[model samples]
Target: MKKFALYSLFAMASFSSLAHAESVLSFGVDPTFPPFESKTANGNLVGFDIDLGNAICQHLKMKCVWVETAYDSIIPALDAKKFDAVLSAMSINEKRKAQVDFSDMLYNTPSVLVAKKGSNLQPTVDSLKGKTIGVAQGTTQEAYAKGEWQGKGVDVVSYQNQDFVNQDLISGRVDATLTDSATATAGFLNTPQGKDFAFSGKPLTDTHYLGEGAAIALRKGDADRVKMINSALAQMHKDGTYQMLEKKYFTFDVYNKKP
Candidate 1:
């Protein structure tokens, strides 16, 4: 009789765990990058990525739970099963591919150098040499700056988030910053705090550093979930759901250029 009771408890616990996992789809996001992910004055998480994530969940018939995570720790947290997937504005690069699998490209945008308006700084090693540039830590921008510009007499500074990078730039602590063009425009340039800043030079496109563009990052071997997300995304595009969500935030076609 005691043996039967032990087996019953084990089976019940296992079923409960599976049940909880299927009830909700958790997505990890760092709400510091505006236009993609950011919190409002009331502490509600709202942004382009947040809406898109919810749409993906709706298509899958699952409840969406947003997990607030720091940008630098998102991947490690994902691997620890802290969340089912990461919806942060994480670029799908070669270095990241070794750590986690990615869904199809979510959207493609370019990296740009933001500096004081009329600074006349070009996005090149020689032009930025001996200048202090800030970038969010643990991002492709930081990797590119450190790897390509650090050796060329550039002083690259790493910050925890994009807002901090913008802060330092506004305060004159850094000569410039490297960030996503669309994000810089929507999150900073169009805002009051970023009035004096503008993108310098042209948009940067490096396959190795920037990867194939942003996508939904998942753990390796989560093939089933990946397929579900990709399929839902394709349908969203076909059914005009993507356009509706996109026009709510951006006026231009963010999906025009694919990587």
Candidate 2:
């Protein structure tokens, strides 16, 4: 999706006791990142991440304060204590682990190549020959698109976010684009411009590039918050609540595995 600029807003309180003895939790996100977290037309932030965050906050009988920031700065902002936790669609990996800790895998997703529907865009090093592909800058998807397709006919076009990429795709500005599979499905196919588009190709599943599953971003040594988020996620998965939310926006569970 779109990598929003620094929205720079204070969400709810950091870590103080809440009203009626409950605890308040803060979650930061890149609001323009769709199918995960993004602002609705009515100005409300609603998406899979929002719903999942809200559910976790509710189950804990606390409030969820959302902070919107640039995708590139989210980790640093979180480490600076701008927010207590990151509910943004951040993946867990070694690079991130050195700076901050993450909760257990909350959801899984894969990266896919999106192009005009019925186009013969195969997932091969050669298929991208002479093709211009779009990707959100600073994302793992961007790295994968460039590194994997470099030296081939693939030309990488980086956009600030998902919406603009879709716009260019509809106008035939780019031959294809690569993004999260979940986003390709919910954010693209459901939109007007994406009605004529579909993501074709096998998922890019290099762990070094895409990382493992997605998790909540937290400060290093913040074990308490991590446990709380992990517990909530485990409950959701156990009770099938995770799949329920997945179906609300997707045809199948796209988490925890590569396509």
Candidate 3:
């Protein structure tokens, strides 16, 4: 019957739609770092990295799923298939490259030492000889401080998250905190609580510890995913989507010029 034929065609179309449903890309993020990725009071994730990831997903026509994970263990979680990639403002360096692949550069910023105004503290070991410095655990800042200052009489304290490090710094528990210059400016120095703090020394340029810039971290051997992300990123750059997002969070260019 004609009615039966119509029903059959409709069912087939529904099946096809289900079979071709949009794929999903899950990104792991540690929401402790603000102006990058952090949770709102309403539990919504918002930041430049979140915006970037969402844009990539939109370009790829995939659903975006954000997985909250600690920064220290995000790599392990990615390896365990807990997420497809990490978009948590992770720096791409030889050390991290050994464990995972990374997309093209996202943004680059320098690391600086933040201390009370007029503290006259430099990042040098001699200046901080008897002082305490706070650093986020599993970050390049922690590695740099521990390697260069810890054994040289500078007490380097490691906090689980950057927020904790900032809190301790405000409480005077730590003489200073080493963190990204942009974050120090936006998340701390710009706030009323940070009114008395200022960057102590010049930006640290030891690529051995600081790495080059931030990028999306993917699981090792996930070349397909990496390629897909790179393609989307290229399109974003070509269409000025990247610059649009960058302007939303930063006044200066976070995407450093390539050599």
Candidate 4:
């Protein structure tokens, strides 16, 4: 009887340790995008996505760990087990769907062109002909520009992150940059460094490139974790937690009404 009790205690302790290990959810993020994920002056991650990820973890009783990753190589890193899921503002496109699974729609925003005021530049092959456009590496904007404008006399330059793209745009190395409207507004255009720039054209709506919306990305075949996150997201929506976080960052609803 004593030996059996001791074995039971050891088994329970081992199971508890395994459960605790499994309860930690690691999220990969590219901290360069503002209003979503970025580091404060003290290197603490702060933004809407960061808050949302923490809320989800709290709701699910899991520990959340953020791993900084480059935007272009985020997917590969996810597959390599560097992190369990990607909590960055990654879009849900067919190309990406083929590589990794994504949670339900988080939010949707339009992509627009930012150029110097009165430049009269538009996001078109003809309007931007012979002009240089900067885009972040591995972004849908990069894919769209490369596919639609690269060979049509438009010079599309790719940067490792959006911050670099915006920097070059300010320096006149690129005439314009195509990026999400929210980031373009909050991260650059609304700041003093981007005072000279303005949205140049109508938002791009090519679903083939712009994608459906942004969501948390997980490795393929991880349906259980995907369902868990989806459930947490649904709960966040139902309990008004999603709106609370959204109000913290944006004035309008970032989560699209349709999705």
Candidate 5:
């Protein structure tokens, strides 16, 4: 009887594992945001989030589909059930939490300032005092910049996209721009404009604003979906897969970190 029971338990465990492997889920993001999510010149959708999303799908033995949406509309679209979840590098925060659930954190990059190299202004908040600062609208960087810098009477310029914000800064229409430190480092530093620009100092983050890190956004009450995503993410973390991707895109480790 003991041997029979042991065999039965093993069979049940195997079946459970198989069941977990069969679950399918869909993901959404803005494909134009490079390094995170974007369409390759080859017309293939590729980015950090896309890679990670596919990883989750692989773990779940699920089919993964890409649904492109505007960066600002991602969360709202998720709430509208436009997709099963979001992997667009949306930062988890209180305001966002009220509308959607989140998976285990995938990355935690900090926000940094970018300015023309010849500008006397620094990237620090004080440097922007009374001067204009540009940020992509509907982002955590925008939240922090407007709350901290704009509240100080520093001019806060909100743009629909980072590329445009970068353009305005380059054209001298904006004094400085606030963006993800890693992105500013990656996108800006690699290009001529980035080389010509520099960070004011380091980046800043508080739990209230930056949150613990970035995660997959899901509609509220989707506990099952959230659980599946978190499971896949945790596995990635334990297996060193997330680390590999992080290193591939960013030299610095941004996973499960404070800043």
Candidate 6:
């Protein structure tokens, strides 16, 4: 009788576990930042984030569904539960922490100022005074530029996305742009239109604006989901899955400089 009772309990527990399992996890991505998230000619989303998100879902035994969002509205959409979490290249800063919780730091990259090789525009308030600088809307670079340089006569223009900023930079629409160095290197500087552009000055770091590093953004108070995602990320690091994805996109370490 005890053996029969034990067997029944085990079956009930197994059924309970299966009932609570999440079958589909929808991720929000901006699809603007290449090497992180972007779309192909066939309209398929691909990048490091896409791969990592899929891996995380695989570990959780869930299907990964990506939802395309604008850079500016992503957080708001998450707040409204339009998607389960944000897997875009979103930096984790205090300002954002107030809006959403973040998983362990997934990666970090330096901010840089990109300009034409001969433009002689340095990334300093005094040097960029009276010059128009471009930055993606709703990004840390935008906040940094507006806070540090806008009042000093620097024209900090906000674009809808990084690709547009790169486009204007190539056409000389703006004197320069402030963006991720790795992104500029891989997505722009290496491209034909960006061949004439070069990054000037050292990497920009701001504790207040730039924050610690990029991570997965989740709705506030979703502790279960947060724990699951963090564990999956740690497992990926331990099993070399993170390294495998990193090798696909970049040569340098993007997961350092924890905040």
**What TM-scores do the predictions have?**
0.91, 0.84, 0.90, 0.91, 0.86, 0.91
Backbone clashes, each candidate: 0, 8, 0, 0, 2, 0
- Taken over the whole model, the C-alpha lDDT of each candidate is 0.88, 0.78, 0.89, 0.90, 0.78, 0.87
Which residue pairs in candidate 2 collide? 1-162, 2-161, 2-162, 3-161, 108-255, 108-256, 129-153, 130-153
Compare candidates 1 and 2 on lDDT and give the better one: 1
TM-score of model number 3: 0.90
Which pairs, if any, clash in model 4? none
Candidate ordering by lDDT (highest first)? 4, 3, 1, 6, 2, 5
lDDT of 1 by residue, 154-259 (tens): 9999999999998899899999999988899888999988998899998888968976788999999887677677877998999999999889888788885552
Candidate 4, run of 10 with poorest lDDT: 11-20
Q: Per-residue CA lDDT of candidate 5, range 135-175, in tens?
A: 88778888888777777769898888888888888888888
lDDT of 6 by residue, 37-119 (tens): 88999999998899999999877678899999998999999999999999998998899999999999999987999998977
Backbone clash pairs in model 5 (N, Cα, C under 3 Å; residues 3+ apart or in different chains), count: 2
Model 5: residue 91 alpha-carbon error in angstroms: 1.0
Model 6 misplaced stretches (Cα beyond 4 Å): 1-19
Whole-model lDDT, model 6: 0.87
Q: Candidate 3 lDDT, tens digit per residue, 1-259?
A: 9999997787555534532463888999999877898898999999999999999988877889999998888899999999999999798778999999999999998899999999999999999999999999889889899989998899999999999998999999999999988888778888899999999988896787888899999988876678678878999999999999999998898999421
What's model 2's lDDT at 18?
31
The superposed Cα distance between candidate 3 and the true structure at residue 7, in angstroms, equals 43
Please report how far candidate 2 places residue 128 from its true position, in Å.
1.4
- Which ranges of candidate 2 are over 4 A from the true structure? 1-22, 151-153, 255-259
